[model samples]
Target: MKALSYLILIPTDPIYVPTEEQAETGADALEALMPAAEEVTYDMFDDVRFIDGGQAFEAITCPLCGKDAQAWWHNAMDKAAEAEFEELECTATCCGGQTSLNALIYQPAAAFTRFTLVATNAGVGGLNETDLTAIGVPLGCKLRVVTQSI
Candidate 1:
């Protein structure tokens, strides 16, 4: 049977910005825009998991003796610094090998804000689009899956 896992990141602080009119008028218009100013709310999502496709396999043969060699699989998650993010690693039980996957979440300290998600896949085979999408973002958040392997 195949297994799947999900991880979610939530912002602990509230997101606020100046009104459209105030932004156009400049800082001097703060007073006028204060009354009509609005707050932006970012909702958090629950983590969910589903059946992932079966593992990918590769045949290995020993060149010296011309014999078959043992093989294994691995998977994991790693988070970047800031917001006290933590890394989580999981290995395949049957394979006895491990892969450390890292999920880095970084936000700028400047006026403009940005978010980035990166993953590292270190194994013989790769993960499918559906599986990466399922694991990367929250259930409802706008998350685009961008994946590459080495």
Candidate 2:
């Protein structure tokens, strides 16, 4: 099967949701840059939700111990899903330290967000710092991109 790619942008702050206007502005900026994208979309969720990279996903690391936490990550994800991801707190198996699942470093990048702007099949590798700043201007917040392929 051919892999499909999505470039997803989210607020740096996990729980932040951009206003409709802000979201529109960000989407416009993204579309302008990714003119060849198959589609662009804005999604707002009532509750925080996970945006994973599917087959592109890589290992997750413990924030406290900096060890591979892939073993613990799935169980934590299942537990968090039980509440629709309203709660992300978990104890790291590596160090037994308290942390939010959102704090774990995903290799290919993932996040918990209430809002997102996505460009499908964008083809570009990733946004540069200048491009990120350009898009962030209208959104009025720092942003991060997660590249998902499946």
Q: Summarize candidate 1's per-residue lDDT along 1-150 as a digit string, tens digits.
A: 422222112212112222334233332222122223232122222221111212222332222333332232121212222222232233434343342212112111101112322222222132355543443223222233222222
Query: Candidate 2 lDDT (Cα, whole model)?
Result: 0.88
lDDT (0-100) at residue 35 of candidate 1? 28
Model 1 misplacement above 4 A: 1-113, 124-127, 136-139, 147-150
lDDT of 2 by residue, 88-140 (tens): 99999889999999889998788899988899998987999899989988988
Per-residue lDDT value at 50 in model 1: 13
- Report the C-alpha displacement of residue 111, candidate 2, in angstroms: 1.1
TM-score, one value per model: 0.17, 0.88
Lowest summed lDDT window (length 10), candidate 1: 104-113
> Top lDDT: which candidate number?
2
- Candidate 2 residue 108 Cα shift, in angstroms, is 2.2
Check candidate 1 and list the clashing pairs. Answer: 78-101, 78-102, 78-103
